[model samples]
Target: MITDVEWATFVPSALLLAATPGANQLLTLRNGLRHGLAPAVSASLGRFSAFALMVIAVAAGLGAVLAASEVAFNVIKWCGVAYLLWLGARTVLAAVRGQVAGEMQKTADEGDGKGVRGGLSSWRLGWQEFLVAATNPKALILFAVFLPQFLPRGAKDVAVPLLVLGAAYIRIEFCCACGYAALGSRLQSMGISLRARRWLDALTGVAMLGLAGWLATENH
Candidate 1:
């Protein structure tokens, strides 16, 4: 069991870590702004669900393997970096094309003549969001590396300590995510012109690209 003192100490750091906001945070924000709050929130849930699973898996076994193999870590790390860059490029392209591209996508989807599937579809959209949250490599690494730091030496069971830490981390993460989603959803209603939207997308894309480059250049 984590002492109250330890929990207090750990929670602040965990919250700070979560507050940094990365690709996943931006993705959730974009989705909320573009598709609406429900869909964005759904994605957040998927992401967190995956994150929880990764923490549990790492605590159980994956952490040891990751800790042991430098080569494996490097490989995964590079892959994650490359993926970030790819996503950044796509965001940039979307911004370059502006609202025409966004509207075109909507038009094409509507042309398919598929009727709205209602609330269930919204939930499914949320699941998609959740899955993205769950699968991000950065989130995986954070759990594997960050949560274990506060574990007491000679803890009776490693898993229990990991769980406590994981729960603390997730609590902060969800709060931050919800806050972002709410804010983005609000801004989405204010209605930007296509030109302004393009600029916003461009800025976000540049930020993502810079972040990706930083991640790629980081030493393990």
Candidate 2:
């Protein structure tokens, strides 16, 4: 069982990490702007689910294999980098063609009656977020290092403690995602012009591309 002091220390650290504007947060913001709050929250849940799985893998000792194997690490890293680049390119192209802004307005004018057809389906968004979080080698490594530190001293079973801590971390991430998505939704409701929407798309695209570059350059 985690002590009170450990819980106090861990909760703040986890929330601080979750609140950082990383790929997950960026994707949530983009989804909120394009599809609305529900889909964004779905995506966030998917991401947290992925993180939970990673924690399980670490507790099961598979994380060591991934960390030590260059082939496994590079494969996952490149996949994440490729996906980020593809998403960025797609967003930039949509912005340039003015499809993003036009479609958003059309959906609004049409009362969003078409639901998933009006934009990305929530299921697809969730799956995409899952893939992004699952394939992130950096996250795997971070979990491998970070989860163990919070383990209770001389614990008989490591897995349970790791799992408990992981759940706490996921909770923090979910709350942060909610706040960020809500902020994004509020901005979307401000009647941003088409030009501004286009600009937002372009900026999101740039950020995605930058993250891809950072991931690509990261050493193991």
| Best of the candidates, lDDT | 2
lDDT of 1 by residue, 1-220 (tens): 6672267678788888887867777766766555556566666877777777878877786866765777877777676666667666877787786753474245234432121246775566566455445434556666788777787766657787787778778878888887777765665556666566566666666777887787677765
Q: Top TM-score: which candidate number?
A: 2
Clashes of 2: 0
User: Candidate 2 — which residues are off by over 4 angstroms?
Assistant: 110-115, 118-120, 154-156
- lDDT per residue as tens, model 2, 102-147: 7677645643223245245767888878988987899988888877
Give lDDT per model, in order. 0.67, 0.81
TM-score, candidate number 1: 0.79
TM-score of each: 0.79, 0.92
Error of 1 at 97 (Å): 0.9
Q: In angstroms, what RMSD does candidate 1 have relative to the true structure?
A: 4.5
